[model samples]
Target: MPPVTERTSSLELPCQDGCVNVSIVVPIFNEEGNVGEFVECVFAALTPTSRAFELIVVDDGSRDASGEMLLRLAAERPWLRPVRLVRNYGQSSALQAGFDRVRGRYVVTLDGDMQNDPFDIPAMLDRLDSDAGIDVISGWREHRQDKALSRRLPSYIANALISRVTGVQLNDYGCALKAYRREVIDRIRLYGELHRFIPSLARDVGARIAEMPVRHHARTHGVSKYGIDRTFRVVLDLMLIVFFMRYRQRPLHAFGGLGLWLAALGVAILSWLGLLKLLGEHIAGRPLLTVGVLLLVVGVQLVVAGLVGELLSRIYHEGRGGAQYHVRDTRN
Candidate 1:
């Protein structure tokens, strides 16, 4: 609906002076059965650490009682902040909303299904804080508690494929129990299903990421929002990630390079056809002539597409007042 600028501008950043040590973001969609226990578990887990924390539960327009429960819980717990979306905008959008409102030095994200153990958060935070080099600590569900075929099999395949494609190898890209330094998380803008690729996205912006084994519990309530169909979506999103990783800056290099190859092949084919025509064997009726002509047309179109890509690339970078380079630090 509203543009991101408009949506974010209206919200206030609730934490200043790093008053909040950790901001835990949980995106809920029809998770009424798990909401109360999830909140309590988070509080109980974080309370023992003696670290000030805020729990932001994003209700993604649940048809069930999830929204009402969050509202009731927020009233009782000052630290619990509930964000109600107008309608379900998927997990990525919901996470982005919570990220925009976070007011902590460190940010953590977990599922509202209670499958992610809140108790593991402290260790993740410790790993992040202990290492200056590590910007993100991703959870790896070592012995996952899910069906072999429906969940684990697809997840295993997807994780392997994503790691190989993105070149930021991690055992479990599907685990939502991740911790990030606020700065690292702030640089990322989540959309579509990009939440699953946060580690790879963080790497794109020069973030150092690490993975730690975390406990995964079987779903206690509500059906899994994901299924075998999600594997197809992941593959599509992975293609986007690869394009962004490799061609985000010099898109012309990718498009133009391929375009040039296609154009060259087309030209070669046409030249051969032209030579055959000169040899005079009635080349007008030849199928090769039509194929050559089609290739030439398609090739020209691709090169034109490349030029358009270059223009759009420039606009994207310049419009945002962003550069192709990211500065880690400056001593001057």
Candidate 2:
């Protein structure tokens, strides 16, 4: 294996023709046995396609020989770009690293495991090209081949819940075989386990999304990285997505609204207690009064916190030159 030096520093290295038609980004973690076969299969699948493309394989701090294999393969395959992360920062960060380096008109993503078929790329690209209005094409594994009890069942529940909450209905949110137009992908900023929610995030940015059936194969190498625990993580990410979709720009609306409602209820209760006391009704040590006080204090704190969040939001945008809208074009 070649020396595993830091390759991320060369992210800005120039491409031959300034751009490629497609950039395929796959994040791998401890998949040494599958890397070579995966590359061969991808090449076999893509060789017939006339479109110029490059494959970016991200080694997410693999404890095995995956990184070394990637480096070796990259040396032989010029179209293959190897990204070796300093450490395991999770899948989302690895994908972001690849996305930051891609110079292509379309971006394709798939798991490094042999489960997702690379031949499906052409159809996804075809669907994207056919409809100029569609910004994303998500793959739906209509006939999944996985352990029904553990993987498939959890994925089914997650997909349904995500679809209902995000309103971006798709048969398989767990399928990593998806394609996005470069412009649409550029607008997305991934964090946490948000990679699975790309369709939803793209939709939030006004992207027109479509889904198509794709092929799926059982894993041949490496252990599955996901487990039942991912369900809880996905739920948390879903909550974040809901807030981001609705109140990313004006966070106060969410926090302040709830705060005001709680505060009102608290005030009403306290006012009734005060009236009772003024009438000599002896309201001391009442549980309702204690509840009212607690609510009032918490409500005030939430409102203040919301105000602070609003200020921080402004600072974040201004400091980074961020905007609520994206400008595709400007004429002099």
lDDT of 2 by residue, 18-136 (tens): 55888999999999988987877776666557677789999999999999998887776777899999899998999999999898899999987888888888888888888898888
TM-score of each: 0.92, 0.92
Q: At residue 255, give the lDDT of candidate 2.
A: 85
Clashing pairs in 2: none
Tell me the tens digit of each residue's lDDT in model 1 across 1-332.
11112122212324344689999999999999999888778876877677888999999999999999999877757788999999999999999999999998999999989888999999999888789989999999998889657888789889999998889999999999999999888788999989989999999989999899999888879989877888899999999989988888887778778777777888898899888778975678888778777777777777788789988888878887767877788996
Q: Lowest-scoring 10 consecutive residues by lDDT in candidate 1?
A: 1-10
Question: Candidate 2 — which residues are off by over 4 angstroms?
Answer: 1-17, 327-332
Candidate 2 local Cα displacement, residue 251, angstroms:
1.0
RMSD over all Cα atoms, model 2: 5.4
What candidate 1 gets wrong by more than 4 Å, as runs, is 1-17
